[model samples]
Target: MSDAPIRVLVCDDQALVRTGYVTIFSAQPDMEVVGEAGNGHEAVSAAQRLHPDVVVMDIRMPLLDGIEATRKLAGPEVVEPPKVLVVTTFNVDAYVYDAFRAGASGFLLKDSPPAELVAGIRTVARGEALLAPTVTRHLIGRFAERLRPADTARPGRADLVRALTARELEVLELIAEGLSNAEIAAALFISPETVKTYVSRILTKLGLRDRVQAVVLAYRVGLVTAAD
Candidate 1:
């Protein structure tokens, strides 16, 4: 990682909320607010010009919405996409799934505590998706139900393991259950750094943005069942 502080762009239509997010990032010793955007159009432009390490994006905005902005900035076709952390009033339905599919590294609540906000930014900056335990347990389950697919449509469960080593697959299963790097390390009798490598490999092999997408893919591919 670079020695420079993590650069962030705070994007939200509401002035008060935007300023509040800037204040949170400003207070962090290792974070800097590079710029701010009041709408998604501004967000995409600032992201391209400033090239921030992370974009703290709000879902609703005046001109372009956060989902579309995220797509433009971090879509799969982009050569080097910046990390995006979606901040909103709530993680409701398609909003959460669509944001992740759009390439957001994580989803966070607007009212999240300052400490959590800081930790979240750091986590995403390190290339990990920030899936709050509460957010994952609740939202992911509902999302799975709403998106139930036919057996023929679902990718074969066995095919999911074709690219991953046994250890990597184990790490992925734990990740799908919402275990953090440290937690997964302890459970598997390995170091956190090793766990990070596995997570990175998983994302690369699956062409996913972050852990949120990994979890969704794990479920869809049948590596994990709803009972898990």
Candidate 2:
């Protein structure tokens, strides 16, 4: 790991919110506000130029929405895309799902406290998905229908399933069900570090960006259900 502070690009349509984020991140020893964008278009442009480790993206913005910006910045098609943390509202639940699908590393409620927002940025920068149990459930509950049942014979299904050891498959299910690392650890009688290692191996084998993508793929592949 580099010794530099985690570089962050803050994107929000509102100036006030941007200011608040800037203030919070600037004060953190582990974080630095490398750039700021008031809208999605600017966000994409800045990301290209700045190459920040993480982007704090707002869902609704002029010129381009955060989802689109997220796609351009962190979509699967992009090579070495930066991590994106979406900040939005419950009312735009569909957009939140789209943001995740667009390759956001995590979602943060717009009204989340300053501490949470800071922690979320750090989490993503650490290459971890910042999905709490509640966030996971909310995501699955609200957007489960959007995920079509996986055709078992789809291009990567067999490969994905075969790539995991039985233990990894079990961990994947717990993850899809929205269990945090510690929770999954307790349930499986394993250490949190071990759970994290399983998660890392799972992501590597499946070519997933983070746990958010892991959860998405789990539901898509029928390893875990929306009902769970």
lDDT of 1 by residue, 1-228 (tens): 578999999999999988888887898889999999999999999999999999999999989999999999987677788899999996586788888777788888888888888898998898777886556655666565443322213455447556789898999888878788999999999999999989988877766666766777666667776665
List clashing residue pairs in candidate 1.
none
lDDT of all predictions: 0.82, 0.82
Q: Which ten residues in a row have the lowest lDDT in candidate 1?
A: 145-154
**TM-scores, all models, native as reference:** 0.87, 0.88
lDDT of model number 2: 0.82
**Model 2 stretches astray by more than 4 angstroms:** 141-154
Please tell me which predicted candidate would have the highest TM-score against the true structure: 2
lDDT of 2 by residue, 92-126 (tens): 66776788778888888988998999989888887
Minimum summed lDDT over a 10-residue window in model 2 is located at: 145-154
lDDT of 1 at 130: 82
Clashes of each: 0, 0
